[model samples]
Each structure stands twice: as C-alpha cells, then as structure tokens.
Target: MRRIWFALFGGLFGAVGVAFLGAFRADALADPTSLATFSLWLGASTLYVLGGLDASIGDFDWYQLVGLGNVCLGLQMVARAAMTLADGTGETEPLLATFGGVVGGLTLAYIGLDWFRGGRHFDLSTFEESPTADPE
Candidate 1:
C-alpha cells in the first residue's frame, strides 16, 4: 500500500519536475520573470514529492530525501535571484541553476522508473503463534 502511494507520487510530481527542468534549460527566455516562473514550478514539484514520500514512509529518517529535494530547490532559487540581480552587469556562474536542474532531472528519471517498475523488491516475513482456546 505504501509502495503504491509512493509510485503514484513519483509518477505525478516526477513528470512535472522533469518538464520544468527541461524548459528552464532549453528555453531562450532571459528575463527574470521567466526564470522565476521556472524556479517556482521546480520548487512546487520538489515540495510535492517530499510530502508524498514523508506520508508514505512514516519515519523521521525517511525525511532525508525531502531535505535533499529542498536543498536543490533552494539552490535553484538562489541562482535565479543572483542572476537577476547581476542582470549581465558582471560575469556570474550559473552553477546553482545548472546543478539543481541536473539533480532534479536525474532524480525524476530514477523515481519515475522505480514507480513504473513497481518499486524495489524486498522479502516479506510472516510469523505464526499458537492460538488460544475460545471461551463459550
């Protein structure tokens, strides 16, 4: 059941993330508004995935994935802000945006594949215990 939820989340948000990243990378729009819009979409996708994972896992340790996604989103936002402020006045490396895009893209691909494949296989264990007599 948990795995199913995870798959659903991955399939949905993963597609959105991939789309936003691809657009940001390939589009020729250089304006701050365009970049901001892309960043917002990426951030939204990140949050959605994180929330879904947390709900499905039900463990604090499972939040690491969410943290990583948030970090990537942060990087994307920071890069966009810096780029907008610079406004071509000074040379600046778009490292944050590029790295975030790469990470998001790779993660989306991995998550989508895993979701489609029905998730990783794990051995299930069953236990039996002696039954007590029923009272009349």
Candidate 2:
C-alpha cells in the first residue's frame, strides 16, 4: 500500500518538477529564471521532496520526513520569491498559481499517503528517537 502510494504521488511530483523545469523553455510559466541553474535547482528540489516522501518506511517515521520536506520546499519557494523579477518576466499571477499548484499537490499526496499507511499518531516529537519494544 505504501509502495503504491509512493508510486502514484512520486510520479505526480516528478511531473510537476518537469513542468517547472520546462517552464523555462516554454511560455507556460511566469518568473522563469534566466539561468538554467535555477531551473535545475527548482527541479532538483521538487524531486528531492518527491523522493524523500517515497523513501521506504524505516525505523524512523515517515511523516516527520515529509513535514521536514514541506519546510525545505517552503524555504525554496520563499527564497525564490524574494528575488526581483528580471525585465519582461511573464505573468506574476500564473507563476504564483504554478507554485501553489505544486505545493498543493505535494501536500495532498503527503496527507493521502499517511491515510493509506494504516496508523496515525502525533509522533512528531519522537520521530527521530528509536522505537522501543512494547512491554507487557
């Protein structure tokens, strides 16, 4: 079930990554970076978030990883937003829409994956700590 969720959402993120990366060469997006490096950075970060979410459930919890990923992606979007637009950048509204689209998709996937995985708890604080065996 987890694998299935990963395969589904991972592909979604990957597609969004490609769209954002391709926005540079295409007219579909505004705020296209003049440098290929930025495109790659955004694409790579998107994929990172995707891959991080797709990582198999280890001893550590998955939500913590995904939550941290939300932070990382949030930071990237914020930093990129801080940059002044180059002359003749495309529509700002569309750019924002595009950004929101990707983030929203990732968030939905995150929550959906959690629901599909069976159990849920507020394990945020201790996700990093090793799990202890239940004592009777």
Predictions: Cα RMSD each = 12.2, 9.2
Stretches of model 2 off by over 4 angstroms after superposition: 1-7, 23-60, 84-136
TM-score, one value per model: 0.33, 0.37
Task: Indicate the TM-score of model 1.
Answer: 0.33
Roughly what TM-score does model 2 have, to 2 decimal places?
0.37
lDDT of 2 at 32: 45
Give residue 18's error in model 2 in angstroms. Answer: 1.4
Error of 2 at 73 (Å): 1.6
Among these predictions, the greatest TM-score belongs to: 2
- Summarize candidate 2's per-residue lDDT along 1-136 as a digit string, tens digits: 2323433554566677677657655543444443433454444454445434555545444554454444444444444444433333688885776567556646644543453342263333332335577897
lDDT of 2: 0.48
